[model samples]
Target: MWLPPSPGQIPFQQGIEAVSERFIGAPFIDNALGEGPGSHDPDPTFRLDAFDCTTFIETVWAMSLAPEPKEHWTDHLQKIRYLNGEIAFTQRLHFISLDWMPYHEKRGAIVDVTRDPGLPLAESLTTIDRKAWYSKMHPAKLREFESRFPADKPIPAFMHYLTFQELLDNPQGLNRLRQELQKGVLLANFIRPNWDTIKYIGTRIDVSHQGFLILKGDRIILRHASAVRGRVGDEDFVEYMKAYKEHATLKGIQLVRFKSL
Candidate 1:
């Protein structure tokens, strides 16, 4: 097995699996992280006791990437969770399609292989209007971001994607996507309609859920923290996709992998 340079601990993608596997039954808490020492956001800056989906992935990846013998995972988490490693609330990569993936892609940290997994690739266009979005947020959350919210102008981005129906029908695409999972690519199953006007958050997001896709022999597993499940858990990815077929806005899955972890 290829291991990252972290002494005895796994520190990359393989390390990611090793690290996350230990938290299979951990509790899931929404909006978990906060600026503990020198900023706003009351939640603890770091903790392994509980996690939301985003925090779970952030914590796992950070732990996998950090050098061992000194548990400095938070340092890695800062860079992964924020723009330019800023710990402030506003600078955090709140939107997955707009801020999170793109920022890491540019830094050579990750690569978006959403299209490489299939034929007949598609796109998800989302308009990000930070000012208008924050206007609808709760008073306290808005107060934390009011000073740094971006302009209200529509910044439309086309996120490369694979259509769920197409992948379901296209044996070729289905096979390829499975191949990617077998290769250890993380899968971000997107949910949210194009031109969606409903207020879900301050930033328009493409993916509503994300998880690591691990393949062992013929069995594929999805490891993630789910509030509905009330804990970090592993589920069959194919079954999960079948469930998403009944969802109103589940667009499809986006393929991503860490290149620098």
Candidate 2:
């Protein structure tokens, strides 16, 4: 759920560069349930790739099923899974967003430089809808979401929003860029919510902006830039790669090269 800065806000790119340089070396701890690596009594609910907003929420829901840990809620989940055919003990790593999720909201602004070839960067952000743009690009995963609930719903596991200035200021929106990071969560490796690795840094931070997460041992960095038809070239890419190295230096974190999406 990360995207590049809109065509506008190009001036904020320096800030983006600064932020990415801040969290290269900070430890990446998982906020998901289960035990951390190298523990003697590993967590039973741990899954390899069960990261993302929806699966993160579902895992929490599943954990809240019982106080004593019997197979109480498995049947309830199975009923839901039969319709979607996706619930399983080991299949947690393969969860994807359902189709029925809502798409857009009227709040926030937008910038559309991709559609209009001649549109200037500054003009794009002047009149844009944040939800509208993402709605068109990534429609709701409706089948995965449900609305028939009680009086209320809790906040999502991770809520990210990034303005054009924020995106321009921090391309890799790592949490360590802020001065004081305050969040109501913990990174743990057991079912009891024992360990938590949530922290924040820098000035402006939101999930909607282009950011990367290194939970557990895996790192998934999301970037949405204009399709590099001709503007960006090999040299620019090399500079970007070098920027990663420099950012790692600032944060004192070492990052191994992973496959790009």
Candidate 3:
């Protein structure tokens, strides 16, 4: 069973530790892709027995905020997953950099600390064309989903993201990234560069993955649900970044830190 720190525990690093301890050997399940989008109702659905990367982090964050997390997990999940705590499918925070992070930051659930380390970062905008990629649903299902929105609802044009190449080019930014890693912040990996048109169209987000940062003795570790490893696991943060750098398609990373309201 999943367990996490009581509400009084510190957020971020402490919350991460609690989640890490509780789910050390949990299996990675692609539950999000399998179960997340097809539903017609606005209710929040979650599976604790298994998790994908996003669900794992979301669950831990919700649990960390409550004295008895299991008792209130759904309520917290609803708040974190949807805008204004509404249960509508369209209200869900789907895009990591564009939707999820920005929503939470605005609500005081977290802070975008990507530029806080004084990194010389460059920004760029990307469009999430849901129709081009997310239109895979059967026409009937697509119609059902779209019916929830007003006919005049305008699609979002773009969102800002920091480039990994910029960090690679700037020694100062690299150093700052390392410094932030040492402090144990939440990180999201942007895999836009590697995603082909078909792949990008399906997901409609620049950020492909996310995880928590931790310091164990002198080593920095990324504690997350590893799709590659097929389970929840921890790895050296720098080594993971090295692997990401080697991938031709991975663009780079963005950082965020949890802050209590």
Candidate 4:
């Protein structure tokens, strides 16, 4: 069982390290959506006992920021999990690049350095049609979705991503990316494959997963809730990237650095 420290018990970097380390070997549970079909409305829902990739990162972030995590994590979770601190499924950040990254940047919660000039060239686009997904929802849920997101409206969403070939070709740029992988920075996994299926059933975003960067001495490690490994674990960054290269669905990565407010 992992226990989180109170906010200010240490700096954000140390706080993230403490929480992530404590959660190592914790079971990976796909329960972020466990509230299920009709329970889409936001209500400070989170579970530290188990986590998916997104919830794992969100939980650690909330724990790091709150003065007393046990007492204030719910409020911090709400603020970080939803846009403008509005508790609606529609307002929740559904896309990493399109919704979460930029919103957090604007709020000074994070700094997105994915487009730094030295990195590999990236392809940018909007995806995951929320309206399209809503259309197929059960009529009852459809009404709820519509009330939050008007069907006639188009939501502006976008993503920036690099292909595996680009990453392999840009050694110097890859070095730059490695240099930027500091403790507490959030690393988003951008998977490339059938966008239609992903957009329809998955998170309406280019990013498929996320984790925190933990640089120990000269090595960079990713502290994440791994569904494949079935628990929270630390993976060497380089090895993790190479493993993804074998997967046809993998694209590349996007990074967000969380700064203390």
Candidate 5:
């Protein structure tokens, strides 16, 4: 069973809705921009090139639940779980969402897997033993590695940790992987992206009914007072999005507001 998020905790469920909206309106996906390295599975079945952070986390979650029995894992099943295949989490009941809201509660536990004292925070959350978990990169030392990437590099450098063979063969490996990702997200959010980042302060506007007002820094962005219901022209949606972007810039966050949720 799952527990509800406390009042002090950020509404990650709401945030997920907001993210979905942004995805619908975005000009281009992060994958198209070469956000991260493509998957390296030789099956010719697991080729995926897109947002590495989300993809990696999602895969870790899927692996945790094990969609099918180990002995029954066929080529078809592997393709379904692999990157090149349809990567929608909802399609598989095993898919897990590792956002802060679900795992940050008091009962939630995180297992830290790092040698350095500060890359990611997993040690303090869960009671699980650290030595039992397996990881190539320590959560505390990720910053040092990321620092090596220059500004000129369009693609972010991602450390290769797990291979298809290891993930499939090793028992209980996926759960460990999921915990590691949760730690990474916590550390990244804690140290780097605060509420100031435009991507974080998302907006939802209604076109047909009523919209909300969003304040980015000091600028006021108007969400369409009316919610968009049906048959709205794409051009009109584009215009509304433009207004939201303008408002975001005025507020001091250079963000592209596109989704409705």
Candidate 6:
């Protein structure tokens, strides 16, 4: 999973704007981070040349959390990526609703704003059995994760989000959506298909993708590293979300924003 040769470390930057500007054109590479320096994939703890959806948000948020982010981005990433900043593959926040979001929420790092709009929302019923999932992985992976998987065991997670039609039916919700998007430093996570989008993988999941919500003037934008577009770019929030109508893969939107540190 390692890249050919990463460039030098990013010069210390203070806020998300500085870090965001530098990663605007990064390529979207899946499994971009590996258990480097000790485990699984060889990729380093951080890099700007490439990012998957979650890593882009993690890296940018890491930079945004500190006064002099360059010095602390590494450890910040660990805090965001793993529960209690435990540096282990098993402790990594693998599931968004179950592990990532709740861990951050408990620590006062981010506040889930999915319910802030007061839209007609519904809770997703997802059965997450990572212990079973790890058991099915290659023997070596099962050994590392099976017994210790799903560190927080109550994780057949249920999350609230605004479905496409629900967003349309509530004009008040539509208006609130616009207002929420305009608030910068926002993170938008896309909940997955209502049915079985990942049944082939033998895992059930609620969240599938994420990006930063960026508003430029009156235009609301989702600044994300797009795998379909092959690079990081700004996409019109409404036009991009139109995929919800075209494909069932996009079930809903969950908004999260960082708290002042």
TM for every model, in the order presented, reads: 0.86, 0.21, 0.77, 0.80, 0.20, 0.86
Q: TM-score of model 2 relative to the true fold?
A: 0.21
Cα displacement (Å) at residue 49, model 3: 2.1
Comparing 1 with 6 on lDDT, the higher-scoring candidate is 1
The reply for model 1, stretches above 4 Å from the true place, is 1-14, 37-39, 69-71, 138-152, 195-197, 200-203
Is 4 or 6 the stronger prediction by lDDT? 6
lDDT of 6: 0.72
RMSD of 6: 3.6
What Cα-based lDDT does every candidate model obtain?
0.73, 0.24, 0.63, 0.65, 0.25, 0.72
Better of 2 and 5 by TM-score: 2
Q: What is the C-alpha RMSD of each candidate to the true structure, in Å?
A: 4.6, 19.5, 4.5, 3.8, 23.0, 3.6
Count backbone clashes in candidate 6.
0
Model 3 lDDT at residue 40: 62
For residue 214, model 6's alpha carbon misses the true position, in angstroms, by 1.6
Task: Give stretches of model 6 more than 4 Å off.
Answer: 1-18, 146-154, 193-199
lDDT for each residue of candidate 1 in 1-261, tens digit (9 for 90 to 100): 212233343344347788888677888888888877555577888876788998988888887767663666678888889888988777888778777888998999998887676478777788776555656664555655655653335577677777767777787855787788766747465656464654665556567877887886676678999988988889987777777766777767777888773
Candidate number with the higher lDDT (2 or 5): 5
Off by over 4 Å in 5: 1-49, 65-190, 193-195, 198-261
Writing each residue's lDDT as its tens digit, candidate 2 over 60-108 gives 3333332323544444233222233334222222211111111101111
Total backbone clashes of candidate 5, pairs 3 or more residues apart or in separate chains: 21
Between candidates 2 and 6, the lDDT winner: 6
lDDT digits (tens) for residues 47-82 of candidate 3: 555678888888777766655644665677778878
What lDDT would candidate 2 get against the real structure? 0.24
Model 4 residue 139 CA deviation (Å) reads: 5.0
